[model samples]
Target: MALIQTSLIWVAYAVAVVLLLIIATVFVFIYQTPRDRAVSVTTVCIFTMSALLATVLLMPVDIALVSSTSNSAEGRKKDWATPNEIDSIIKTLKIVYYTLYSLDALLCLLVVPFTYFYYEEYDEEATEVGDQTLGTRLWGAFKYTIAFIILVVAIFLIGFFVPYAKQAKNDGRLDLDYFQRLLLQNRGERALSFALGLLMTLGTIIYVLYTGAGLALLPVALIKSAPTVSAPTLAANTASQLEENRERQRQLDGRNEGRENGLESRDRRELEALIREERTLIRRERLAAESSGEDRHWLIKAWIKVEAVFRPLKLIGGLLLLLLALFVFVSMFITAVDKAKNSICGAHCGYILGYLNIFQPINYIFVKSSKVFPIDYILFLLLVLFLFSASVVGIATVGIRFLWITVFKIRKGHTSPQALLMATVMLTLITLAINYSVAMLVAPQYATFGHQTFCDRAPRHPGEQPDCTHNHKAIRPCTEMSKNAVAKDVCTPSVLSTFINGVTIDFPFFGLIMFWAQFAFLGVYLVVFVATLFKTPKMDEDQLDADLEEDEEEGLLASTGKRFGATWQDITGHARTPNYGAAETNGERA
Candidate 1:
């Protein structure tokens, strides 16, 4: 029986993991698509709505489980004498069941219908492209609405009426045990039936309201606007606008080319004069320089000084950014660990710890004992240390490179190859550290619970165990059982441990991959920066003058045209902007 139970549980867990992975991959693919902004926004809105519905339904279940375990009777039968635990549990169950029914009704009757309408509106313009007539689309929508309403009503009936009727079957005679009767007569049963009925009636009313609203609004909109322009009129208008734009563009291009030609002519003349002057100076200095044996040493000294100052500053800035990135990564890692610990270690250490182990496969190995390692904090510290070490190495490399370039007056661009090598080394170190950290954090959490021995022994059967040893003495098993039996007996643990372990296993590796990917981007940027620095420099004055002239020409062209053009005035016979009509002239004498 235990083997069967464990196998089934494992199968369910595997199925869930596969489903989640598929869902995540699908979403990632959708997000990567180059869809238009409106389509992407609509997709995100729908996804968010679905996620919210799922979260709302699942959160209640989680709460019920936690509440039930926390308030369970000491012995299984102890809760039989006091009805409150059973009553509270039944109440919670009913609330959860009804909430699910309400959500189903909402999705089918409200969200689905609303989504259909929204899609219809969005696709209205595209209907003609696919040769789909408006009447056909409307008919399809009507059929969908009817089907959706039927499904919602069916779900409501099945979810509420089945449970209610089953309770009625068990309770009508009042011959069963106290617990059975209590379950049959609970308030939750009544609530579910009532809510289900209300939802069905409400959904019908809403459908009627939607039809009436659509009828009233459609004609008003149609009356306020004439039938849209025919195809021929649209085509003619588009062609005419295209022609007008072409003409305007031709005129603008002509003016630009003429201005460019004039600038070129002036530049050519200036260049010729500068060349002649350079030749004249060369001729005058050639004889004297040849005789004196003088050299231009100052220029080389100045270039070396400029390179010295700039190199250190660049290295320092790069190191600072790298360190900041590492710090952020470490902080996020620590926060994840702390959250996992708090979630796993609730108020009752022994019970909660056992519950957590159910989800973590590693707990199976250690389930026989109570002794557990403080692995969560240790994993967190190791991650921090790895990130800190990487940061230190990065800072040190930057400092060493700075010293080599500035103090040593190394040849221009000579330190770049060394810098690249250091970056590669840092990248490798960080990658390995991150991998090790992730492995340490994730692998141990999944290990079997083989380390703890005390937990292995069975408590003497309930009646033989000491009263003081049990926390909930009122519970049947604890009050009546021998210590040996109670210790040996095992109950199913909570699945929360699996969830936390799964997160630890997946997130760190994924984070490390992302970190390395980001480093690749930084490396590419650095390579580009180095290339730019080593490339030939251009004369600044000529580039500045050309930029200024381009700006001036753009400004002139922009100011030359009215936004709406002359045709707009001719058609409207008035300007769009406010105008104080010349003070209405009246014959002053009159």
Candidate 2:
């Protein structure tokens, strides 16, 4: 029965793999169209999906391998695959996932510049089609070559600062003893992180409150500063708008009138339809031409602005992201190495695999609160996972918006103040919400999953499975095992114990590394966005006034606050007396 079940699992895995291949083929077909300008985003999405699909497929294979054991006739245990073979396969799969994730991140970074350059090139070509000198073209090509060289150099410099090669010296293995000692040596770092996070949180709250109050008072300020327009000017402006609307109405009526002038009813209907279709086609062509012209104009302006503004930021942003990625990569390598050396079941190796898991919300907070707020370890882990999902999904929502902007050529909206404000609010909210959620939901459920899963296992021996609870579950769970624990019991509170200022604490090394890495990425994003906001242009006075007027006309807001006399009249349901001579003349004119 077991053998049959294992065979079914393998078959299911094969079917899933085949389905993934078919989906990939479909993506390939979609990518082949020349007019499919969304290819970049589509390609990245498909590749990331494929990576996730592959990871899911490999998980079942791992489970099957772990569960497949045979009983021998001589009363000895046998296995289908050796531990070494299974470990090798698991490690290889892990490497594949890690590489896919890194590539996905790199693609995200690359898309911004690539999209900018693409539109710039398109604009240049559109301009140079009819009248471009050879010298000018050559100069353009020369500049492009220089820019490409600089981009390559920039990427290299960014990668150089990552320290990956240094960490890889010990085959990416993390020495727990060395790490613990380093923690003691660098006590100031942990304190600084906590201090910075707390300060930032308070600062953000204060800023929000202050800003909200200011916005609430803005209408009063606007009312006080409202400009006065003469009655004749207002009337003239209103008359001009009315005249424009009348003209449009006349044109629409003329079309209807023309349609009614036909002889036969069927012929009249068909002819009217044909004429309407022709008019529609012409209108569409005109609109498309105007749109293309506008796009070309804006593309040139945007490209110039991008160069003047964001080009300077590229090096700084790249370096920051690079450093953060490397930090995460090193931490992941360390975790994997520790798990392998300890011979823990790969399924229970930390919370998740690769640097992607670092983006999860679970972190040092759980470790810090576990002692003070106790609960089931399994429940705590699940809560952490849930928070991780929510936070990552929120971040991805913003990311997808960016992808859409690039793919759809929505460059004009990219640097708007409203967009920047929204981005800031969303990011800040996500950060705060995740921290609070983890504290409230996950922290209270914290138990000794780490110790139970790692410590209470049997000693390593030849031809024997490692002390993995999942592999050999005759050993009691951590909760039961730790209850009767003595000084000699393996069910200790900590898995990788460390000293912080001579105080022993169960150091959540993986969690802290990931948490800091997240902060580093957020820091880079915040700096870049704030800088961009500063660089972006504001609407001129005329445009601002026009927008305000439109909003007021649409009943969105009051143009001006009423005076005290008017307010009193409104409250009392009273009418003000008018000048009799002026009123008599106005009535006669009407």
Candidate 3:
């Protein structure tokens, strides 16, 4: 039966993998297209559907494994049998589910980078049609490579530490049976479960909160400012300009009609001619005025003024996001400090020691409070804000620069594409540094708190002294606890290892690394776009003439070459022109 079940599990895994691959291939094909409104909508729909299906399929396996072995008997004997089997299965399922979910998250994050890349490449290809420059493309490739390296390192460290922290929580639960024994003698398992549960639950909550907050900020930052001119406004302006021109033409025609009526026969003829000339002059004036007005309306200078007015709004939005992210960071730090204190002193030590110990008062506050606030939540929120702020700053900087370039026609001195590529690299590096610093600062808190719990478990080991327990007679020394209890207990080495592994994989550190890498790519693209805006190639008059002449010469050569290559009858038949000499002779004979 076990073998059959295992085989079934593998079959399910295979199906899921195949489905995911198919979905990913579809996305890849769509991603290769240039950005368009329809494509964006379609991409979002595809991603959401794929993720939903993957989640639905994944949840069943997790539920089945967890539910099947949840009530199994515990002991060394059981450890070698059903209990260990169940635990192993549950752990495997959890890891698999988390990994797939992370992949889902990654795919969603990838949309931005893919769009940016497509747009940038299209722009480059379109602009550099005649003179291909390899510098920008090469530099972009180099920047992506660097970003990928940073991402890998960050993910590795996150994956390494998270499991260790979870293991500490599981290990601390080893004294559960001992607590149950004490309970039969009128004691309780409250202390042991509380100690273990606090670390695991709190650590998870913190990580989730921080990650959620960070992700939430991305969309807010991306909200485009309301368009400066709506379609209706443009239409109204066009109608008004047309009306003004028509009124001027009508007045000119009335004046010409009056002059035409007051003349003698010869004078009247000349007057009619004068009226015709005057009407033409009026038409020319009307056309000149209309063209001038249209030019003024569409000038780059006008758009710059509009952008300038919107600048403050963007700055305000960006600053708010930054502040929110900063708040999350500070909150995470505080939570970490509290958790560390709790783990070191044990669950209720803060309450007992707080009045007596001035240095450790904070721990008491954390314990007596019914809810331990999650620092990670704050960190996640801050991350969201940070991303939002960074995006805003990036857009604003590029937008302003572009506006100036367009309005003022600023000259870019060099034709080197390398300059734009370098700017992109710099921007990407800056984004990575910022994200890394944030993660590093937040990760240590989770690690420190988790570690503190592991240390507290040391004293609870089977061989330790029994001074800590309330009932001396009822409690055996740590040394007296059976090997079976140590092996099969929740706090056993195996359980601890499993728990640590779980926590490490659950946190948002990996996601953050992926996000920052993509952000770096975006930054590079933005730099390229801004550089392109400022640099307009000088129009080569001589080159333009030479190109035109070359085209004419090619046409002439192609005609001659085709005629020469043709058979004589075919060439002569098509070469016959109008027989003008024959027509002239016929007319003379007639």
- lDDT for each candidate structure: 0.32, 0.33, 0.33
Candidate 1 clash figure, as a count: 44
Native-vs-model 1 lDDT?
A: 0.32
- Give one digit per residue, the lDDT tens place, for model 2 in 1-590: 54565466556656666666555434333222223334443344445434433433343243233323212111111344444644454455445434543343333234333433333343445466855554554455455556655654454444334222222123223333322232332333333323223323432342233222222222222222222222223333334433443454455456566555634564345445545434433433333232222233344333333332343344454355344333433433444343334331222212222112122223334433332212222334233333323233223222314323521111222222222222233333333333322322222112222212222334477534434334444443232113322212322222111111111111233233333333343344344334433432121112322333343333322233333443333223333442235343211222
lDDT (10s digit) by residue, model 1, range 1-590: 32343344335434433543444333223222122223433343334333322322232233223222322223222222234644454355445445554554454354546444544444645675876675665666666677667775565455344333332234333222321222333343434433334343332232122211221222222222121222123233334433443454454445557474543554444444544433433433332221121232333233333332343243344355344433433432333343345433221111111113223322222222212222322333333333433332332222323323522111112222222223222222333323222322222322211121112233357543234335443332111012333322312112222222222222222223332333333343344334433532121112223332332332311121222232233222232332223653111101
lDDT of 3 at 317: 59
Query: In model 2, which runs have C-alpha deviations exceeding 4 angstroms?
Result: 1-81, 109-112, 124-462, 465-590
RMSD of each: 27.6, 19.6, 22.8
Q: Candidates 1 and 3: which is better by TM-score? A: 3
Clash counts for all predictions: 44, 0, 20
Ranking by TM-score: 2, 3, 1
TM-score of each: 0.25, 0.32, 0.28
Task: Estimate the lDDT of model 3.
Answer: 0.33
